[model samples]
Target: MVKIDRRWKQVVRENSQSPLFICLGEKHEVHLFETYFKYQLREDARTNDVYLIHYQDFTDPLTYGESLLAEWAEAFKSWPQGTAAWPGVDFTVTTGTDAGRPVAALAELCRLYPHLAEQHIFVQIAPTVVSDFDALRNWISDWGRAVKKGGISKLKLVLTDHHKHQTYKKAADAVRFRIETDLTAMMQHAAEFTNPKKGDPEADYQQQILIASNQLSKGNYNLAVAALEKAVRIARRQKLPEAEVTARLMLAQCLAAEGKTAPAHSEYQLAITAAGEKNLVAAQIHMNYGSFLLSQSEQAKAKTYFSKAVDIAEQIGNDFIAMECTRLLGQLSEGILTGDAEAIRYYERCLEIAREMEPEKRRQSSMPYVAGILLKKYGEKSAAGKILDEEMRTLFGENWIDLTKKPKQMK
Candidate 1:
């Protein structure tokens, strides 16, 4: 029996030089193929000089004759010569097949200019159903030989099929790697917050939101949106009013991130209506809604929502929320909502709250924003400079004052 582990690793390493192989069995195998090459490219830092060629063209094979190789080759040739030597590397993709046409074309070009082959890497990925396995293997062998003769360092053949093929098993040993998906990790992490002993509608709702948050962090926005929507439905079904409001607000935030402003606004409006009173979660909803409106350039509407949040924060006696509300109120007052006097009032209130908080939390929470507002609006350049310097000394105890310079505005 082949020591499958050692054999797979050896093939993976050798193929790193000129890996030509087929992936057969399951729709999952295509995802695996993509993952394997992605890992290899990232590991070797060959991201710039990696190519992916799709052979089947589309779901319909009738339109499969389009070859992108000639265009890719011409474009590669037009690039500044010797770009791939020492400082640069280029990648090219090609598709379609008239048996050995692409391989032959590449071989001829490599023979004409050996350095071009050395500097560039080529990849060919064909759907396994279209061509006979024997013919494909023979072509790969011929192409591999040509690649070796031309002194090319890397070439890869990726063949994909939905069903296991006897030909692949007979000719090539299967190499596999597990790929992590955002959805899988999210579900696993959500499971952590679940407790049968403390099970309740609120706990379930929080767990769902946590899962959605994880999905968002992983850049799976669609999944996050879906999860939030489901959480809302679950909360409503269970008659958990607070959970329903929170879920709707979370959904609004997710939609805003996706730039779906109209729907997000509608959701935020629904959340505001549902919240009904001064509550921590409701205040958060108002704050997020206000921020969203500001981002959308609805400054007047944003100010109304921010003012509501500020009132709720004060009612709840939550200084953290009050501080945030004040900071945002100050930001809005600078231009969006009101005049400079209002801006200064809000800033001063925020500064007061920040000062009253524990020193560590104050440093972490509000000093940076306060310093920024002073510099930008008050034009207290020296005072802003001094405040930032002194705060860093007292809080971070580091002379990282130079790190706080404003970024250049883009035209």
Candidate 2:
């Protein structure tokens, strides 16, 4: 089970809140639910009464997929809605992992009984349970519509995803949700006025920004550029300097990934100026700008930005970002950038920091990163090799990091 992040723990302890946990795979997901309940009790001894539907009751899978939802909804309508004993009983609905069937059924139930909106908390534990083959995409879209159209109540949806996984409890959460929260309020004014104020372009701009980021993460640079370019236009037109800076930064990242040095550099400068040195986004801007410079073989310039990022990351106590930047710095130090003794010293220092991370995190990220950089630098008849070769092989097995072979890719 994943550690209880404070954001999630807040959600779990929320009295009268409902969580839909998703569990799927070849075996049982005892951990997710067990952890959920354990944390719930630990956070609040008097956790709200939860009306849980494990949904082992449904066995039929409509070969067509659509019929399953309809049928399940019909069967589930009879279950007790929160005990009418409490006038304002908070109700939660949860489905861990295998959310396709549960989602389909829940959507139907919610649509049939509008009263549930007042008390319903729909929890999606591990939303990845709904995959492409499950035809769950349409179900998810319909569910979102239900929540948005006021058919499911005016309350905002509670959503979290690995991609859109956000801790909305943060200060930054306000900007994104603010536009959405105020739209209905804006509608009231529109009704009284002869003309509706132009639609809030930030709404669409935010969406485009999200799309662009997703595309970039998935290695779809061209599509990311397209979406980000559109977002940039909307941001500038709407006088959203922050949005413009964010879009330009993302666009620069895409451009750099595509190996377009000159334009990427230009965008980085414009975005850096817009974000200023002290903005929270400065760390990201510097880190990414460093990567862009490194990609263009501007190793020295890259090193400076990386160092700046390290400083901000340290100030902010973002060890993850600090480690990643340090890793990149280590790469540059030894890999054709400047194989000086100072670089060698930095590599050893960075490795020490990596080793200090939590065991799982260190193994999954830093260990591989440090091993790759060292092997690339010292693995080939190199002075660094003769000194650290035995130690490096011990850290990463010979099979995993082969020093004798030419490096397959630049970091």
Q: CA shift at 128, candidate 1, in angstroms?
A: 46
Error of 1 at 16 (Å): 12
| Per-prediction tally of clashes | 0, 13
Candidate 1 regions exceeding 4 Å error are 1-178, 182-227, 257-259, 335-339, 375-411
Across 1-411, the per-residue lDDT of candidate 2 in tens digits comes to: 233334344443452222222222111223333345445434354434223322222222222223433443454455466322212212232322223333444444455555554444434322323334233333333344434443333222233322243322231111121101122233344443634445658666766776776566568888889989998899889887788888998788678779886888899998877777655677878887887777677899998999998888778766667777876776677645444556656666666766677766665555555655565556656776655556556655665454333223323
Q: Which 10-residue window in model 1 sums to the lowest lDDT?
A: 57-66
- Worst ten in a row by lDDT for model 2: 172-181
lDDT, candidate 1, 319-338, per-residue tens: 77788777777766786545
